[model samples]
Target: MACRCSPLLLPLLGWSALLLAPMLLVQFANAAIFVDDRGVQHTWDESTKARVAVRAGIGAVSLYHMGMREEQLAATWGLWGVRGSDFDPENPSQGSIYPEADPSPEEAAFLASAVNLSPSCWKNPRGCFQWDDTAEVLGMRDEIDFIVNIDNGSAEDSYNAAEEAGMNVIFIDTFYEYNENCRASNYSIIDTSFCYGRSMIDVAQRIEELAVFLGVEVDQNSLNQQKQAACDAAQAFTETMKDLHDKGIRVKVSIVDTELRDDTGVTTASVADFDPIELWVPRTLEELGMPLLHAASYENNEYGYIYSDEYFPDCTPGFVNDTCNGNTYFPVDFWLIDSRSFILIDDNFKLIFPDRAMLAGQYWSYPRNDGSISYVMIESLLNEYRTRLGSAVKLQDSTGTCTPADPKATAHLVADGTGGLGLNEFICYDEAAIQQEYLQCPTVAPVPPVSTPTSPTPPTANPPVPTSPNTSASSDAIMVSTITSIAAAAVTAFLMFCSTSG
Candidate 1:
């Protein structure tokens, strides 16, 4: 131990010691000492930290309410065991009581192997405070070192029961109450008006705090980056929509529940059917500078009526009278059908507004609240706008077209070959029969009137050739060829002049 080193090695050893000091400090920092709500302190090294188990109800509801952020983070980091159940909406109590009926094998295995802190409740003939039975049912009674409970009337009994069973209890109500108080103090009246419940941001912040309380290391930087990316995508989409609007290429869209079709197959569901918080799609579009048709009128309607109950008694709300007040709100450039609706409703909408486009699928589903608007959803919306609006612009530039006809004047219900009445006749700019029937055709008097006349009829016997949009590609190639030839000739002449001078 007393062996001497050379003078040259002394500096190298000192430098090595300086470099290793922070590494040793980090190793020591990784050992966490967490204090539970009961004033009980627990220590764990890096290898044997406590395992977490989220209640089954929390996992089920968080999917639609909080975007499943907590579950996703836990699964990705392998820090927690998730309890899942086969949810039955008709009999909701079955899911909360049963642990063996879990549908996901992966989740079940995680719960069985890694659960040491149980934050769950069970119901019986008595009530929901049976913590010992819940722990035994979840197969975590032997291994569970702590029981986390909410400090509310609903969970106070459960906390006492767990403590009576000789287990430490940690109350999580302070985290939730703190966030609620912060929101009340900081949020403006308008901001509070938009909020339906605890927002995704609140959920995320609470999760981060809970992780710290449980001595779990979370990738907070990565989570913030993901959230920032989503906000950036939403902002980019808004800017794109603003640019399109400035170019006078406004795409009017209407959200309809096609499931509520009338006898004549016309959609009876209007903006009145949905609550203010559920109208996230229209609200987001309006925020992005793209106002949806009839949304404002419906929002501001004095009587809060959008459709008549005379024709659609089954679908209309009970407050509606027998008068059609919102017949003029149907015409729009495109329709966004509710995801719950039938696919055949597309035909019904086409018969009513013949020139309009439609997009359907789960992405266009109803109840589009704050939790539903993710980064992927924003990207999808941007793609739809680009595809639909780009095609319309290209078509209009090539073909001199007018605005679609008034739906009220053109659309009519006619008797089908069968005994039923169906939506049959509608006028559109593309329809040849409607064009000939009108004294002034849309081709003759194009909407947003173009300066160049694009009439097929001319004074000469031989009509002039019509220019197709495809010709631009060939024209560009020809111009490139001409420029290349001129450049080659100029270069050759300059070389000849130099040779002659020499």
Candidate 2:
């Protein structure tokens, strides 16, 4: 009457459940999504179908001046950061020094001489004063993330517009043009032409007089106020741009003898009170401590002196070396936008570090008065960086598809080759692109469905007739019981016999 048990059934049911549970867990984990504090979400290959896309942008100076409408600016330069100065109520157009309808012969003569002597001077006199025209003629409006205007009065408004459009802006100090007489042409109210007409010492004394007239502290009987005025004007400009800090825009100044504080009243300690120093001058290859170098046009051959070379040897034109030998403090604001500065570094990097490094910078960033060599230089540099760096990060590119030659390393991206270029030295973008591409590519092999094993069919239920059993079940039980009883009785009898014998 005892129930018969089937041992195979228990194991079959338990193992089937165990295997199924793990499959379900894995599928659930694969389906989950996570996001970061910045609102950037992480997506796995399986979940990235509709969400994955590219970002494109540009970097230009005075972006609005490029004839790009607010919407166009947004579409082209939206992803980069915002910068530049606000339009000045005092001088609208952000210190844009356009030539008056006509200038005195003396003034025109000085400007002509400067244009001829200064390497940066435009071949055409009228072309230099036309920002909008330059932008149109150069076809720059269509290219760039945002624009950075140096000592531009309209920098803030331009930056705000850029921010709204999702672009970045930069404010360069006037120091880059301080030594250039053309600055007076750009800012005619400065009376630089008259000052330059005198002896250098007399000019210096006149400058001191002007600074005193402006109510700024100056050396007793010294005429260095021109320098002081330029510095003060720059400091004021920086302060004005710094107001946008709360809104997330960046402002920067350049290194100039004026910006360098000999005035004990405004020492380096107080310098931090204003805008943050953008670039540290005296940049040396040995001191960069970085694997990649970003070069602008002026950094190219013979044009290298436009940028500070205190840490490099031979600050002279066309001479490229590492480190500036002198110990003067150099500010790095304008260097970021100076096209000439990039050219020198570009050639230097190519010649020396071709195996490991590359350079990138803005193309068509400003309204180029002369279009002679920018396009050719830009393409050459781009190709050079790509070929040399192989695969490295291009911080400026939005596509993020740019990859290195080697599949294992990172590559740089240039979102819009028109506006800016970035040196992704760590190959950050290359590695990311590879991972993304790998995850995105469809598998060639077909995935087979998981098969559930079935239990083998048991024998038919028909009872087998007693082939040789001889009706054993009925008699077998009775015989087994009888044998058990007899064994027990014999044991009892033995114990009794032992007791009697004792």
Candidate 3:
């Protein structure tokens, strides 16, 4: 007969096994370990004295899920020459060879030179990693005090590395991961939909979860609570980080736009109900006690492309529905407007200095891998602006990629003006280039009075009752022409896409 186990122990053993599985997984998963000064140990090490170099990994869902493989990450940092311990059990591709020192002198000099220009802020403030890694390849470690993993790796791994290196973290909250539209934001855990991606509703939820994970226990409430319990929890968490904050391990949580939580009914609107952007502004102003560095995309057509009646004919129909004639009826690109508006309102808060309200040039600021180019000519234009402005202007390159501020202390701006005095600083070139573009634009100029030949009859004391319906008719006709052109463009676009796809 086969050996038989006790039936009574079956349930007990099963329950014990269920509990042990998570414990075992936790132990195995605790690749990064930390210890405080008193010898207290923590599963994920987040406290350290070494500076952090945050890297935004490339935009690949598969890569993101797999986490940061060692060899892949090593290639990113050029670890072939750098000698150090290679302990990555997860990825075998990592090389044992390591650089004895930092990047080459030429690269360090290049980074040093690049940091002086503004608008070349941090690489991908959102979550794209290519730009982030490029900064490291160029030897920004000497300049950047900390390398917070924007999308450098999984949150756990990133925190672990930061702790191991003794660097602070700039934890960009993920709204879609816990929002009602969790499934909808399929591409990125954090939506890249401007204001929608950074709304407070999503932010509040994300912050609460992050706080709990960071080993804090603030009171939280259900999602639908009329009062903002999530916001409170976030505020509490930020306050609690004070302990680590005192240790010089500061954490900054940012929302790219203010209107993220507002109900704008646009694609860029956040699915979360909380208004974290709005809540963050005042608190960031009052509680954080640090001058808020508010950045926003300006008003313009998507990608700053002039897709007029010339490019997209099908857009005409959409334009027709909005106006009497199609001229002024172009679609507002609500999503773009809302995102820009969110940041614009923040600029309106006079307390925020002009430098703080750095105007992000266009919505799609960076070059897309799929052949999309940046709206503004960054290199040539900014260089010209810097040359013209003299000492009155300061530019800070945000890691020579897509951040709003430079890593070095220099002002990272192409061109900036004095306070609300309505002064416009030139970023591209002298007044001539701007004037030429202004002239070429489609905006109608004010029509001046025509000096027509006088009739033989002397003018009556009161001018004969003017009976020119032509002016009104012309205005109406212009409007109609504009509307028709836009509608035609949009319809043409739709049909073209369909035909091409099919």
Candidate 4:
């Protein structure tokens, strides 16, 4: 796909003190807390909350590459202000930005103020950078922290580039692409990959980070408590999986998303010997057997950004790494052991999160569509399991039998065939569509055996010889008759000549 970044050509400025380190902050009050220049505790405000809500991640990547837009940022802040009560990421058919949508003027003003931290990044035409390896484009920025180093195409090159840039570089190859030189974190680093496993928690921390950097301590006890709660949710989810297995209902993880893997430059997976920061998740179904879904690639080194790889078959190339906007990308290297897609079966024991369009990140893709994110809080995902216990009817096959072509078929869900969510919109997961996807046909009927031909008669070679003898006699008789006729004709010709002369 075509990705562009800030390409302004300017002289490099000396590096500034490393921007706020996330570790300097601690948790408090079960909420986000960060330390500021003044050493005071700070919490996320409405505007900060809004910005962090829609962001899959917050960092140098989006700022440098990925073409992050001001309007989308503003919309995210607006949407964040109305999560849950005012908005539902799970159900998009309802709500607006205000009473639903249209954030209040004061809220709008705050979002605007909060969002313009790097007006220079947007205002300067020179800072726009587009990376298409072979593209003959030369551009630079003035006074940046990181210096980029070049290697033909290796992970070491990325590290070397980061080292040369004089800035701390966290390789997020799973989520976003760093500058080829690996120098700066402008727009490209501003991805929301971090929001995948940890939703509200990331929101709180990201907001606090922004508030502190813009001018700010975020709560230590609160955030600590939240993390603990998140861990609890993870534990609860695993237990629920055990219960489901008892009921013969199972969760088969289809595909692990791209951001859920390690950097292409590093190894695909971690080993006892090394810690690899790729793969967006922790302990996948393949590595650890939880009710968690596992992933298989559409092709070697390629995967669907969508909920399942099956959708990859349906996808046509667009942007987002030449993939269909199923939100699939390179598996992110970092993943939480506990984080998962909330799409699951209801206690009724039927499918819940079945379709890619209804899955998380539907609106938030790399090419960056106008879709908004729903706050699938840790609690909501946990609730999905709790809500599904003994709830749904025994799922039936497409033929209406409990034993579908696939024994795993619990039920069937059909798509409304609406195809996709509207522009800048996302429709919730369609259970019917998901159910329909599982129903399969049993074995095909066997064809009748082919009849064998009887062996050819031994030529009745004698019969063939008898027919040849007759043929030889007929030919001799014909030749003799022809000679006799010729002789008779000559005699008649002489008589005729004599008659004519007389």
> Over the stretch 281-353, how does candidate 1's per-residue lDDT look in tens digits?
4434433444233323232322133343442343244333223222233233334443223233455543332
Which candidate has the top score in lDDT? 1
Structural RMSD, model 2: 31.5
Question: In candidate 2, residue 429 scores what lDDT?
Answer: 21
Clashes of each: 0, 82, 64, 112
lDDT of 2: 0.25
The prediction achieving the highest TM-score against the true structure is 1
Q: Worst lDDT window (10 residues) for model 1?
A: 413-422
Q: What TM-score do all the candidates reach, one by one?
A: 0.35, 0.18, 0.21, 0.29
- Give the alpha carbon lDDT tens digit for every residue of 361-427 in model 4: 2211011111111112333334443444324221211111111121111111001111111111211
Total clashes, candidate 1? 0
Lowest lDDT block of 10, candidate 3:
417-426
lDDT of 1: 0.35
lDDT values for all models: 0.35, 0.25, 0.26, 0.27
